[model samples]
Target: MSLIHALVAQGSTIMAEHQAGKRDFSQATQTILSKIPPNNSKLTYVWEQYLFHYISEGGFTYLVMADDSAGRRMPFTFLGELQRKFIASPTASSSTTSLAPHALQSTFGPVISQLMYTYNTSPPTDDLARAQSELAQVKDIMVQNVEQILSRGERIELLVDKTDTMASQATAFRRGARTVRRQMWWKNKRVLALGIIVALVIVWIIMAQFCGAALRCGSN
Candidate 1:
C-alpha cells in the first residue's frame, strides 16, 4: 500500500480500538505527546503552550496524571489558551529567527520544507491552526535571516546549497499535488461515464416507444 493508504488504515484501526474502549484516550494522547522531542527546549515549550490553548478552547480537560505526587489533576486550559494567543500574535513571529546564526543557516532549509508539509495537512480552524500559523511565521523568519546572511557577503556557497535544496523540495511538493489532482480527476471521470451510460439507456427506451407509436399510426 502507498504511504497515504497505510496512514489511513492505521488511523482507522486506532479509531476503532478507541471506540471499542480497548485504547484509552489519555494513554493515546500521552503517547503522542511523548513522541515530541524534549531536547529542543524552546520548541518544546511553544508546542506545549499551543496544546494547552487547543484543549482549553475545546473545553476538554487534560491532566498530567503521572507528574503530580499527590495524584492531583490541575486545570491547564488557561495556560494552553495563553500559549495559543502568544503563538498567533505577530510579536512571537520572529522568535525562531533568533537562534544561533550557524544553526539557523544549517537547519533552515530542511526545517522550512518540513514545516511546509505540515502546514499543507493542517486544518485552519482547529488546534492545527496554531501549527499552520507558526509554520508561516517560521518561514518568514527564515527568509529574513537568509537575507541578512547574504547581505554580509559571507558563506555564499552555503546559501546557494540551501537554495538548491529548497528548489528540490518545492518540486517534490508540486509533483505530489499534481498526482493527487490527477487521481481526483480520474475518479470524477468514472462517475461522469456512469451517468452518461444511464442517460443513454433512458434515451434509447424513449426512442423505441416513439418509433412504435409512429408505426401504429401509419398502419391505421
Candidate 2:
C-alpha cells in the first residue's frame, strides 16, 4: 500500500492538507466527509488501497489517508503526533472558531511538514515493529512525485526571473499607456477643439437656413 494524503479539518471545512502520492485524491477529500467517523476511527473499503484514519478532539479532527498497507496503527500514530502539535501550538489553539486554512498553515504547517518529513524519512521510534518495518516496504515501491515535492535553488532562480520579467512588462505597459494619453492630449488639443467648433458652426448654419426656408414658404 502507498500513502496518499494528510489532512486536518473540522466538520466540512479543511484546515490544511499535504499529499505524497502521484494520484489525484482531490475527489476523495471532497467526498470523504460522508464516511467520516464521529469519533476516533478508521474507514477502510475492501476495494480501495487508501484508508482514512481520523481522530476528533476539541472540535478539531486530524485525518490521514494512506495505503491500506500503511496499516491502521501507523496512520493513527502520525495523527496522534499531529493532535499533540495542534494542541500545543498557538496556531489552531488560539483560534476560538473554525480555523482558517491560511492561519492553520502559517502556524501548523511547519510542524505537519516536519512530521511528514520524519515519517517519510524514517518510521516513528515508538512503533518500530508495526510501523517502521512496514513503512520501509511501502517506501521501496513508492516513487517520489518530484514535480510536486522538489524545489532546489535553480527552481527559485527561475521563479525570480519570471517575477522580474512580469514586473518589467507591467512597468512597460504602464509607461506606454501614460505616453499614449499624454501624446493624445498634447498632439490633438488644438486640432480637436477646432474640429468641434467647425462642426457646431456648420450645424447652426444649416438650422438657420431651414428656418429661413420655412418662413419664406409660409409667407408666400
Each prediction's Cα lDDT score?
Answer: 0.33, 0.63
Candidate 2: which stretches are off by over 4 Å? 37-47, 127-220
For candidate 2, write residues 16-127 as lDDT tens digits.
Answer: 7777776666555555544454554433332235566666666666777777687665776787678877877776656668655555665566677778767767866766
Clashes per model (N, Cα, C within 3 A): 3, 0
TM of each candidate vs. truth: 0.24, 0.51
TM-score of 2: 0.51
Native-structure RMSD, model 1: 22.2
lDDT of 1: 0.33
lDDT tens readout by residue for model 1, 1-220: 0000000001111110111122223333333333322222111111111121112112111112112121111112222333344356443344333333223223232332333233234413464445445545542211111112133332121212344679999999999999999999999999999999999999999999999999999999
